[model samples]
Target: MPYARLLPPILLVFSNVFMTFAWYGHLKYRDTALPKVILASWGIAFFEYLLMVPANRLGSTVYSAPQLKGMQEVITLLVFAGFSAWYLGQPLKWNHWAGFALIVAAAWLIFLE
Candidate 1:
């Protein structure tokens, strides 16, 4: 458990990847049936939960719940940024970066002692 502090964030990053896909990966498949997409998203979310639950459980040991949430939020944005540009073919605009920067700054505040 030497990597306790580091591990949770890494796990969260992976978890968020799955979550982002589960939530948004269907955008490109607009013609797909709603029920089919829902089922697929659920399948993807199962994996997300697998990683997310452990990430939270382990993160609680080294970080407060707020801090862990902060970490996950930031990681979600970062992962989504990449997935947006590369997978969804939608790059973030400058305004989006500005908004995310502010959010990240707010997350930093939670980490302050």
Candidate 2:
């Protein structure tokens, strides 16, 4: 397989990490100041966009638009699940797992010809 096929998902993982931080890391600093938090989140999101744009561009080489979007959604859920539990101290419930499983099932359908 071409190495390019692997680049997008890896970059997307890094991008998601930055994106999760940008969107949710601010919970820890809720008391700091709204404007400051927004500014900081935007700064972090800039890095996310950098990786995300290229990830999509590279991913498009091997994956269709819907496939790429589905992959990203699954990745975001996985990343967010971990981040919510570890960083935000919010443990996932059974319902959350069930919901995620349903999403995975949907992904399966999406990937089917």
Candidate 3:
């Protein structure tokens, strides 16, 4: 499918992945000194912002501000869930899936005309 509108979603997926890792990866690095952890997180966060900026800009062309925000929120939750499951070795529970489903519904509602 030639989904030109999907550019935003694709960008959002990448942005969320980078952002989630940037945010939570530092938790695992907590054994390091606080200053070092902060510095590294900042470095990673810089890249996250790079991706986020473009994602929002592109999404705005195809969706309203509220819709874009909803998409970002949903993408963030999805990215964090995956990160928790794979990197943190945590299992996804029914409750987690339920919450994600609710979030997805909210996204749909937000974008609805």
Candidate 4:
């Protein structure tokens, strides 16, 4: 079914959102103690793993390992770009966009037969 192809990517995108926040969302709250931030991040990461496990299992049916990894990287970049700009209020510079462009190109290559 079309859902077999569509659902995994969507799930992956959501998982990456959780992961990005788990990894970087703490920067905005520097006043919080290290222990607290670590615990909170770990808590968030648990949810990320929850989504990632299912996404990968389902994605495996439609994509190769490299393709899934490449897709995840691209999704991570897109999500991080949005999160950095909106939630962190840190805009990406030209070099950052150029780097991301290169990553997208690399990901495109992963899908080629």
State TM-scores per candidate: 0.99, 0.95, 0.88, 0.97
Q: What TM-score would you give candidate 2 relative to the actual structure?
A: 0.95
Return whichever of 3 and 4 wins on TM-score.
Answer: 4
Per-candidate Cα lDDT values, in order, are: 0.96, 0.91, 0.82, 0.96
Model 3 RMSD in Å is: 2.1
lDDT per residue (tens digit) for residues 1-113 in model 3:
25547888888888788787777787766578988877887888888888788877877777788988998888888888889988877768999899889989989999878
Q: For candidate 4, write residues 37-92 as lDDT tens digits.
A: 99999999999999999999999999999999999999999999999999999999
Worst 10 residues of 3 by lDDT: 1-10
TM-score sort, best first? 1, 4, 2, 3
Prediction 4 global C-alpha lDDT: 0.96
So what's the TM-score on candidate 3? 0.88
Per-residue lDDT tens digits for candidate 1, residues 28-87, read: 999999999999999999999999999999989999999999998899999999999999
Candidate 1 weakest ten by summed lDDT? 68-77
Which lDDT value does model 3 have at 77? 87
Where does model 1 exceed 4 Å of error?
Answer: none
